[model samples]
Target: MLVEYNYVIICSDRDFSLDLKFRLKKYEDLAFVSFAKDKTEGLFVILKHRPDIVFINLSKNAPEYFKMVVELRQYFHNLPIIIGISNDKQYVFKAIKNHFFDYWLLPYSEWDISKSLLHAKAQIPEKTEPKTLCLKSYRDFQYLNTDDILYLKSDNNTTCFTMKNSSEIIAYKTLKVFEKQLPEQFKRIHQSYILNTDCVSGINYGKNLCTIAFNNSQVPFSKSYIKNIDELKKKLAQSAIFANK
Candidate 1:
């Protein structure tokens, strides 16, 4: 199903803004599309509309432009942002560092913008039920809150969801499938287990085991997956620093 989303373009160049607005109109799933000529007006539009996606044009010479993007990230954590630039390699690297969903070169084709829009759409959770995942088992469907899930274990072809309440739900899908559907908090620590990092209380690297707070289960991580644990630690540290800020 196509999800309807609102988006705003913050571009100083009027001609480029108009061209982008025109291209975006072709997507029937996009709605409440608006434009702003500068950061001041863009902030107002963003606060008023709370758009699902934001497209901002970045100038290589303008340090303030990059600062504005960083401020937006602080205000709207995890909101999908697309960067627009003109053949600037430096800006591309900065965009990637800031976790912009996608970037398009100036005078981009309809296909290029469309592809970025599709990617941004996929990153955004559905507004109606943003925090829930629907898992199918036989003819019945199970709705689960992403936060309530502690971890998932795969045995043969089946995957088991271990919830915060200590209840388990068996689904007929592989752990690989759930890895994609779950939010960023979920990570594959082992070939057979996908863990929710939020529920992780401790990690014993010597034992190759991590403890989950929800059920106090010691899930093992593979040697090849040790890098995932390192990355998770970095992510947690960054999150802490951001929270303090």
Candidate 2:
């Protein structure tokens, strides 16, 4: 699936918004989601939608908008890409200090906006979370949400996928083939098994086993994959309120 970026525009200028909308028709992937009249409303809408990009009209109260963006830090570790629009070149320095994506002059250069958006696309990659895994064989095609997959086991040349719903799906392909295709959350714990780390509730170092919390099933992990297990432990520990050895 092609990734489409959602954007929110915070501008009181209707003419600029209309013009920008007309110009953005050329950009198929960049879709506008919501619009706000002022910085306060912008903050509320931004927090609600969490768009990929935010265009702020910095011509008025640039400092206040910057402060509003800083306030958003309490809620998000990573903020949206902010593009400042103003008639004053003075705001460019401020925008840079605040780490804005790009600063556009009010007169609006079509080429400049296009170039900036291209650069933005290069910097900010497509959101790949909760991806869909497509399985195709001959004329048959099966689409599975990667989030619903618990783990995969290799049975000779075929791979069996265990879902969160307790249903099993068999793909006429080797486990090694899908090993590289699945997201980072799915890890190769054994030669025959690749487990989804999200589904793992606990790891028994003594038995070299991982507990799948989804169904309370224990899966074995060989000593050879202890490094991956250690990293997984540390990754999961960061989200825990407290952990004791």
What's the lDDT for all of these models?
0.79, 0.87
**Backbone clash numbers for all candidates listed:** 0, 0
Candidate 2 deviates by what RMSD?
A: 13.5
- Give TM per candidate: 0.48, 0.54
Per-residue lDDT, model 1, residue 88, is 54
The TM-score between candidate 2 and the true structure equals: 0.54
Candidate 2 residue spans exceeding 4 A from truth:
129-245
Q: lDDT, candidate 2, residue 217?
A: 90
Candidate 2 has its poorest 10 consecutive residues by lDDT at 121-130
Q: Give the per-residue lDDT digits (tens) of candidate 1, residues 1-245.
A: 45688888887888877876777788999884688878778777887788888777785333555666667666776655555566555577777776777777756777887787777787777665358999876788879998999999998999998899999999888999988888777889999999998888778889999998867889999988888899877776775634331
Worst 10 residues of 1 by lDDT: 236-245
Q: Whole-model lDDT, candidate 2?
A: 0.87
Which stretches in model 1 have alpha-carbon errors above 4 Å? 1-129, 238-245
Clashes of 1: 0
